[model samples]
Target: MSLEENATNRHGSPAHIQLPEQLSSKFIDRFIRLKTTYWNREYAIVLLAIIGVSITSQQFNTYIKYIDFMNQPNKTENFHLYGCLSYNLFGYMIGLIPGGVLATFYPAHNILGICVAISSIGHVIVIMSISYLNSLTLCILQMCIGTTMAVGDLSIDRVWTYWVPLNKQSIRHVPMVMYLVIFEEGYLRDTMDKLHNEHSSYSLTLFIGVIGLAWYVLWLYVINGNYSFGSLNRDFILFGGLNNSRYSFEAYGNSLTRSIVSDIPWKSIWTSKPFLAIVVLYVCDSRLYQSYYYNTDLFSNDVFEWTMRDNTVVLLLLVVVLVELFPEIALPISTTNVRKIWSCSYFGSLGIIFFLEVILGNTIKNNKMCQYLFKEMRHLYNFGFYVNTLDIAPKYASLLSSFLMCIHYYISDILWASVVRPILSFA
Candidate 1:
């Protein structure tokens, strides 16, 4: 028995693993040293931080506003705006499949920078199509906008994962959220709108061209494809053609790199129970995104009521002035229970919102209260998003969640592109 005990003990757990208390001053000191010494690779990180945030902030802010602007022909009917949003979202969702594949191959920084620049073309195209009376241009612009948005969104996650140490993804998302906050406040979008009004579509296009020029300069100067470029141990690389790639993730430290395209975690991800729950959670995010609206126009003049504008003004004020009027509640729960609550809350709210719309506020003039209530409610939606993000670790949280977005968007796109848009046209 003693001999058996000794043999079993010999195979016992290794002792090299440190206790929790051992993660003390020395552990922190090394991380600090790592950051301070410019030890992090990828010069593009700094530029990506600035430009990616800028593009996303402005793109989001102004992208939807165009639906309103497009409906400038009639001030009263903004339901067409929702149609436009659906158009954008549809395009975005459809394009993400190829977008993810492209990100796997492309030089991430360059692709991101180019995507940002080209997205402006999409905006300009909308203006030209409207002004010059050309549906062709509008279609082109819409398609491009969808494509660029997919590419840029993909690049942000891709590049972030590359440069940010696996440890810092959560902290990184906070700044990303800050940029989102900026867009929510309408800094860049409003600026673009003002520019659009002041200039012809061509002139606006030129203005965007200048912004693109600046972006390219910044991209080339600061952005790089890999972090601390030793050997590109990264998962993938761009090749000669539109849809070719070198390889993903190096095996061993061997100089001879190998293709890992097949090794993508798709099946495992889809099969895992936790992954499925997260997928359901993220699918709810898409719904929350849609429901965070002052309109239920499923097209035409039934979207983004006047109350949305008013509530936006109020939201900025309350958030800025009181600081603590609304508690920035951070829920620390990633378990199934939390996901269930959040999903139900959002879904329940959506149900109630629709119910109220039918009973109290169905028509534009009749449903002023419904419109107004939703304006307030939309801000509440942010908390739902917060709850969802809060429960998870930030590391690849943006990514893994975004992957779900990729899937949702893809399916939504197919439905929208094939069924929704054509039906709307007929209707």
Candidate 2:
């Protein structure tokens, strides 16, 4: 009836069937290329989803800046601001472990979408009730927002690890870099603030929530059937959409098992030298960056004798530099030992810049230039230590990232309160 059937005898099994080896190989190669193309599209969508959620979650930061706390007493105002800020970090720290654990047990795309949707909804509620917000209420809302953001962040990070191959793993960092670049450029702040002032913050926030739901719907379409956890019986291939299960390939079985490690080696991970080194590097880098960010206005006022407009101008200039240089300078650097090399070199230069800025504090030009260079160096940490956690342990990448970040937050709080603040006050 057909070529394959015609090759058989009257018994349907008496003939020796042969196929051209070249033809078979060509067919396999073509399938592989098609699969690669499919996965590349999936990866692009993953990055797009990441960009969407990150922007929505972070948009609230600008709105929070506009909140009126001037009516309260000085002590009350300070508590509302600083206390709520601490609650945000605390909530994020608490969420990280649970978020990572949930991602390990469930579908990452679902988790990301749901978490972001909930976060956006939460922000909408908070913004709707902005007039009723007090210190306690604001703190509670911030903690809730922080927890959801942590979960969303973990889910996206975990999903990419599952979706992307080792050779192309570095591209996973691009979404985050782009997020930073966009926010630093003040595009979101300028546009969203204008919308909020003209229309309403609640409407804007609700729109973001709708987008989050759309992300979930898109994920369901993209990763259903053979790609998700429910398709364990399907062929274990990098690309999805296969339904046949006749072949019992041991390699496929092994790979499927490897993807979900039932037993995580916690003891080995904690005691590992590389893990400890990465933790230390990240902690130190975060401490410097956080301290600098929180103290910028104070430092500008006290040390530089700069007005608010001058400080804002300095920030805008710094953003311009980041926008122009980040892609050209940071994106091309492969995730290799060179990441560490560049990070260390840039970090070391900060001390020199800081010294010069402080020594020549009276000169506005020197102060502005030094401040820009010093702040720009902090971005190198993302290219280096931030991605190192994922590179070292892809299966537990979210878990490890959350753990390290939690530790950094805790340590930063302690060191800032006990050591750094006192030194700055004395100086």
Candidate 3:
């Protein structure tokens, strides 16, 4: 009936396809060990990113806290005024393009280092601006900071996509929360409540952040993260190749770029549904994050009776994002199921916030009472996004969420900025 049986009947006896139990187990065991090792190494590198960002995230939190505690008009105006720096938003729009280009043409550490070094310059400037405290200077510095942050971020994402296993990528977000939790002061409503009077916390945090980043440069070197083993630049820069010129390396990158750029047809992108969805997702998710960042002050206003440190602490952000994502990622069975669960949670989070707002408006007359009500509600909703992230696959899951979020995020931001900020704000 089968080819093997026919061959055996026509010729001699069938060939034995025997695998020993010990050999099979040993082989499987070795494979499992190798996979674990590969995962650990990549994870360790990402953990270092968490460590490096901890200082910066904390500094950003300190800024949010300072604005809240001081309750300054200048501090409130900073968010709206900073919006004039369209450079920050523009950075997000085009951020992923260069990374895509580099991944297509080259795979190495030089690109990574270049991205980090440029971003570090942004951090350095922010720290410097804080020490100086001129409003105009701060706004300009914020614009520069946004540019470098986008550049560095897009570059890091490119590397993650290329090297990390698609299945395990969702777990990557757990460490992503570390900066929010440990460094950003997400869960410190109690501690921060007691320390609100101390103005030095903001200045001291920035000073420490600058010193901390100085060590990230060393961490990069320790990891041997130089893009290429023999960096693309070294061959032309130090070893002297293709003409013994300083700009020789430029030719290599340029030629590679030209070849890649020429191959890509611009028209095909619009026709691709998956690509469109991804862009939508990134736009939406980033918008929510930006809105959230902009609102800490309004929410923290004692007039509104919400404390940013207590309400939106970095740990809360980290926990809400991570706790839910971990189990879903670990037990993924089907994409369809993941999508269903994701939609449920996404909508659920939105619903909870809406319900909380309505309840706060109706039941709580006293500002103090409203604060307690909203604070509990905030914690509950934060858990929703965490569940949403973990249930979906990162490559597609994050992109999908970003796309859907983008639609509502834009509508909300425009409405909030144009209509709500002026008319509806309590303060």
Please report the candidate that would top TM-score against the real structure: 2
lDDT of 1 at 382: 44
lDDT of 3 by residue, 169-275 (tens): 33344444333444333444434435656547556545545655564555454355454435434433321112222222344555755655554444454455645
Runs of candidate 1 with Cα error greater than 4 angstroms are 1-94, 105-107, 117-146, 165-172, 178-187, 224-261, 281-344, 358-427
Per-candidate RMSD, Å:
12.2, 13.2, 10.7
Query: Looking at model 2, which ten-residue stretch has the lowest summed lDDT?
Result: 239-248
**What does candidate 3 score on TM?**
0.51
Q: How many times do residue backbones clash in model 1?
A: 13
TM-score of each: 0.53, 0.64, 0.51
Candidate 1 per-residue lDDT, tens place, 197-262, comes to 876635554455456546654554444343333433332222111222332233233232122234
User: Which parts of model 3 have CA positions greater than 4 angstroms off?
Assistant: 1-39, 59-112, 115-138, 167-206, 225-270, 275-332, 352-427
TM-score for candidate 2, residues paired by index = 0.64
Name the top lDDT candidate. Answer: 2
lDDT of 1 at 211: 66
lDDT (Cα atoms) of all candidates against the true structure: 0.51, 0.61, 0.46
